[model samples]
Target: MVLSSSLSHLALLVSLSANNVLAAPRPSSPMSLSMNLKRRVPEARSADDISAWAANNKLALEAKYGNTKSIAKRSSGQNLIVNQKADSSFFGSLAVGTPPVAYDVILDTGSADLWLASSDCADSACDGVPTFKASDSSTFQNKSTEFSITYGSGAAAGSLGEDVVQMAGFSVSNQIFGVCDQVTDNLLNSPVSGLLGLAFQTIASSGASPLWQTLASSNAWDQPLMAFQLTRYNNDSKATDLEPGGTFTMGATNTSLYTGDIDYNDIPDNDESYWLQTVSSITSQANSISISSGSSALAAIDTGTTLIGGPADAVAEIYSNIPDAEAGTGQLEGYYIYPCSTTVNVTMAFGGKSWAISNADFQAEQLNSNTCMGAFFSLETGSNAPAWIVGDTFLKNVYSVFRYNPASVGFAQLSSEALAMNGVNGASTPSATIGSAAATVSATAGTRDANSAVALFHSSPSTTGPIISLLAITMTMFISLRLV
Candidate 1:
C-alpha cells in the first residue's frame, strides 16, 4: 500500500543530472532488459478457503487503511508485499547480496520501501518463511537504523541495511532496504519474500528511494524508463497458474509488446507520489458519469492494488445501471454482486483517451450458480480518497509505461500475444513445464488488501463480528449460509 510522506508537497523528484539538466535519451534501446512474470490465483473454492481468505483479507485492509493516521508520526516503513491472496497477483524473483541468494518479490508501484524477512525475525508472520541472513552475504552492511512499519494486516520491526540486488541482467549495489526481526503472521504467509516498489520516493513510508530510481540513476542504463506487459489467467481453472509469458522491461518500452502509439499522460502536479491522474469520465453503453466535471476525483494507476475501488456512492452508481446487479454479502457486503451471466462493459478516461476493460476481467469470482462478485469494490475513504485504484483488472488489457524524466505514464494496446491471452482465462491449453533460466523467469502476484470496508460485514452467527481492533467496524449482521 502507498504511504505519502508529504501530502501537500506536490512535486516530482529533482533530476540528478549535470546543472539540473536531464541526460540525453538513449537511442534505439528503449527497454534494455526483459523478464517473464507469473500469475497467482487465490484458492477460494470451499468454505474453508473462503474463511481463510476473509481472515487474511481483513489483515490486508487493516494495513492498507489503519496506518494512514500514524504514518506521518513514524519515521520508517518497509517496501512490503503483503500475504493476502486475491483473485490475481503477479511477482518475480531476484537475487540479493553477494553469491546471490534468490528470493521472489512483488514488483509493486503502489508504495516505495524495499524490505524482507530476516533470519533474526521469529514473529508469527515469519513462520516457515525464507529469511535474508546478512551474515551469509560477504557484501552485506548493517546500517543499524531501527525501523518499524504498520499495515492494516500486520506490523513489522527491523533494522535498515544495504546490499546488492539483482534482477534479470541488471544489478544495483548498496541498495538500502529493511530486514525484519519481527512481523505479524499475516505477512509471514505471503507467497513471495518481499516487495520492490517502483513508484516515486515521495510516497515511501521510510522515505527511502525506490529500486527503479536507483537503477535509473546508476550506470546500469541510459534512460530512466520501465514498462510492464502483464499476462492473464483463467479463474475457472488453476492448471496454468505458473505460466511464464508476461514480461517486464527496464530502460525502455518494448515495441514488440504493444500495438499503435504509446500515448503518454502527464502526472498531475498536485499528486505527491503515485502515478495519479484525474478521471474525466467513466462510460459504458448503459450510462456515462462525468467524474472530473462533477467532483474532481483522482485514480492511482496502482499495480499493487487488486481491484477498482472508489467512494461508495460512485461505485454504487456504476453498478446501479447494470441489470440484476445487487449488493454482496459476508466480507463483501458493501461491494456489488450480479448474475454470473451478465457481462460488464466499462471504460476509464484519462489524457482524453478512452481505455476499455475486457468483459473477461469483470468476473471477480463465481459465488454460486446464480451470483458472482462484481470486479469493483467500495472505498470507505469517501469521495476524498482517490476515486479509483485501477489495478490489474484494467492493466492486463494495455501495455503501460512509467517514465521518470518527464514525470508521465503511458499506455498502448496490448500486442497480439498479450491480446490472444487476455482476460480471466488466457491460455486455452496449459504448459507441462516451466523453466528456471535466469533471464527467462516467472513470478507470483497477490493482493494483501481487501477492496471494501471490513467493518461493514457481519461475521458468522456463532461469532461476534470478528472485530479485532479499535479502528475496525463493530456493527453485526447474520447470514443464513452455513459458512458465510
Candidate 2:
C-alpha cells in the first residue's frame, strides 16, 4: 500500500506488568536483527496516484513549515534485509507487549509516532487484524493520557500505554506507544496493523517520547545511527512471500552494505520536522539541463513515500527531456506518463555530492500496454511545497544513514550485492516494448528499504517471548485535500 503520514492515539487498557524492562537484546557475537518487509499496492490506485500522493506531502510540509529553516542530524546496531513491493510501501514485523505479540508495521521516516490497533478497539478499523490485548500482558501500563493525532492523510485517536517492544532481537522495555481504538479505513485495509515513525520527536503527534529516542537513551548501540538496505525484486513474486529481501541495521553501519565513503550532510536544527535538506541542482542527462534555479531549496528524505516529487515547473522540465512524455490523464493531471521505452538519467546534488537516479528508478509502473508512469511527479501547487520530496524511488538506489549526534543524513553507493539485486548493476533487460519491458524490470528492480534499528539484548529461551501478530497502519492521506 502507499503508506502516508504519521498519527497516533492513546487508549486505556487493563494490563499488568513489572516496570522492569529488558535492558537490551544480547547476541553471542556482533549480530544484527532483521525482518522481511512485504509490499502492497492498491489495485484501484495507479502509479500516478502514488507519485501525486508524495507530492501532496511536500505541499503539506510547506504549509506546516512555511518559510522556516530547521532540521537536525542523527544510529548503528543490527541489520536485517527487508522486502518491498513494486510501486508501493514496505513493512516488517516487531513484537510488542509482555509476551511479545508480533505486529506488522510500516516503518516511516516522514512522521513521528508509533501506533497499533488496540485490543479493546471495537471499531471496524481494527477488524481482522492483530490487536494488543492489554489484559493479556503482565507489563502493560495505562498512561491515562488521551490524544487525537491528525495527519496529512489519516488520523488515529486513543490513549497511551507502556510495554516491552521487540524488533528482531533488540528490545526496549517500558516503552510507550499509541494504543489506537479508532483509525481511518484506508489504514484499516492496509496489510500492516500500525505505523512506526522515525522522524524527530519535535514532530511526534502524541506528545510522547519517540521509540528511537528510547533506544538511543539506552547504551545498547555503539552509536546513535540507523541504516536501511531495501531490496526491490524483478517482479511481484516476492510481494506475498515472507522471504528476505534486504536488511535494516542499528548500532553499526554494515560495511558490507555499501561501497566507498558514506557522504553526510547536516540537517539544519531549525528544520526539525522531517529530514529536510537543501539541494543545489537537479540534472537530467537526457537533455543536459540543470533544472534547479534560485538558492538551494529544501527536500525531505522520506522512506514512507514511494515516488519522487517536486515543484511543477521542475517536474515538467524533467519530463520534457524524455521522448513522448506527457501529463497524466483526467484526475491524474500533473503526473507524468511516458513511453515504457523511455530512458533517462536524473541526478540531484546535495551535500556537495551528485547522486544519480538510475534509469530503472524513473520507470515507475506500467499503466497499460504502451504507457508507463514516471516516478517523478509535480506538486499540485509548488508555491508552498518544498522544492522536492525525495521518497523511496531514489533512496532505494543508495545506502542511506540518518545520524542523530550531528543531526545529519548521509548516502553512499550501493555495494555490488545491492546493485545486482536492485537491477542497477546492468541487470539484463527484455527487448519487448514498454509494457513487456516494464513488467520485466518492475518484477526484478522494484526498490525497497530494509530499515533496521538494532540494540543489544540478552534473552534466555524462556524470556524470548512470543511473537505478536499485530498490524501496523499505513497513513494513506498526506494532507487534507482542502490544504491543496
Candidate 3:
C-alpha cells in the first residue's frame, strides 16, 4: 500500500500507559526498563569504535551517527537488521541493545514511528530478510492490529504487535512496532530487516499519532529528535556492501563536533508532511533544490522526477572540477566516472559560500587496484519508478542541518561559519564522467565550537518537548554505534 502521510488520523489508535501520552508493549525481564522511563546515555564513545564495527561487522559500517556528543559516534543508516534477540523500546532507554543490534538506527528522519519488523510474517520475502520472532523473543505480545509500512524504494508489510523496542541508547518497554508477515519487496529483501520511520514522529496508521508526540507527551528521552552525521557512503561499492556511514549523535558532539552557529526552521502545527520550505534556489539542471537530509529525493524533492532527479547538469559540471576527469558511463546517463586514485576537490554553494566535501567522501569504494567511482550521480533511468533519493552522496559535503526557528517554517540552513568549518574529506565516490568547470562558491574556511550543534528539542505551551527539539516529533530516532 502507498502509505499516505494522512493515514495517522484515519484509523490509528495510540494508547499510552502513563495516561497522558500518544502510544505499546512491556519490557521482557526485570533488567529491561521501558524507554518511557529513564536510562543512562553514553557520554564517551569515540570514532574509534565506529571504525572497528564497520570494518569488522557484516552489515555495519565504521561510522556511527548521533546527536549526543559527550562520548561516541556510529554510522547510522535509514534501515535495520532485525534478529530474534533484537532489543525493543516502548518508553525509555533502559532497554537498549549491544554490539550490532543496539538501538542506534538509521531512520527515514523524514517519517515518524519507532517500529521494528517482527519475525512473524508468513511470506517468502521473509526468507533471507531478517525477522523478529516475537513469540520466541519472550518479550512479545500481539496488539491485535495488523500493519504495513512503505518507502520510496521499499515497503514493510506486517502486523501491529506489542514488544519492548530498544531505542537511542537504551530501551522502550511495551512498545508498539510492526510485525511483518510479508517480506519487504525490492532490494530490502536481501539484507535490510526493516525501516525505522523518523519522519512522522509517531507510530501512526489509523490514528494521527506521530512517534514524536508519543515520546514527548510520554516524557521519554531528554530530547525528541536524534542527530546525524553520515560521514558519507561510496555507492561506488556494491549497495549491499555498505560501509559505516557516519555518527548519529544524541544530546552532544564529540571532541570533534565544534560549537557553531545554528539556524532553525519551525514546523507548522497542522502539517508535518509538507517539510515546508521556500525555494532555496534552482540547480543548474533546472531542479529546485530545497536541500533537506530528512527529505528523500524520491518523495519530497522533484516536481518532474519521473525517475530520480537532481542537479542534472550540475553533476556533470562538478565532476569536471576533478583534474584529468573522464566523460560518463553506465546507462549512458552522463554520470561522471573516474579512477579511485584521483583526488577531486568538490564543493556546494549555498549562502554565497561553498561547503567542501571532505577527502574521505571524495574517495571511492576502491574497486580492485585500478578502478574507482564517484559519490554523486543522477538516479534517473528511463523508467517510471521514482528512483530518486538525495542521500549522503551530497549531504556529507555540506552542514545540511535541519531544525526549527521562531517566526520561520519547516527547517533552516546553517550559518556561513557553521558550514565553512565543516571540511570535505575524500573525492566524491568516483564518477564516470566529467563535464564543465562552471562557477564555484568561495572557499573561505571557518570554524564552530564543538558544543554548538544544531539542537532539535521541544518548547513549552507549544505541546513540544525538550528532547526532540520541537512540538514532540516521533521515533525513528536511532543512532548506530561504530568505531570511526
What are the models' TM-scores? 0.73, 0.73, 0.48
lDDT ranking, best first: 2, 1, 3
- Model 2 lDDT, residue 462, Cα: 22
The global C-alpha lDDT for each of the candidates, from Candidate 1 onward, is 0.51, 0.53, 0.30
Q: What shift in Å separates residue 177 of candidate 2 from its native position after superposition? A: 1.6
Tell me how candidate 2 scores on lDDT.
Answer: 0.53
Strongest candidate by lDDT? 2
Query: What would the per-residue lDDT of candidate 2 be over residues 386-479, giving only the tens digit for each residue?
Result: 4666776788788888776667788888998766655222212111110000000000112211342222222212221112221111101010
Error of 3 at 252 (Å): 5.3
Question: Could you give candidate 3's per-residue lDDT for residues 302-390 as a string of tens digits?
Answer: 11001112345545655556655565433223344466666666554322333455545544223335434454544332222122323
* Candidate 1 per-residue C-alpha lDDT over 1-484 given as tens digits, one digit per residue, 9 for 90 to 100: 0111321110100000000000123235332322222333444364333323433342343234323111011010001111112224454445567655655555566556778888887676565556788887887989879876654445567888887665434445566788888866544333345556677787666666666665554423344566666655544355234343355666556666787787778778745476777776787645886464433476667665555665667677888878899876665666676777877888877766788887766665565667666667665432333556666667767887777767777888888866664333332212111111111111111111123211111111122111111111110100000000
Q: Which stretches of candidate 1 lie over 4 Å from their true place?
A: 1-87, 188-191, 236-238, 270-272, 292-296, 382-385, 422-484
Worst 10 residues of 2 by lDDT: 13-22
Q: Could you give me the TM-score of model 2 versus the true structure? A: 0.73
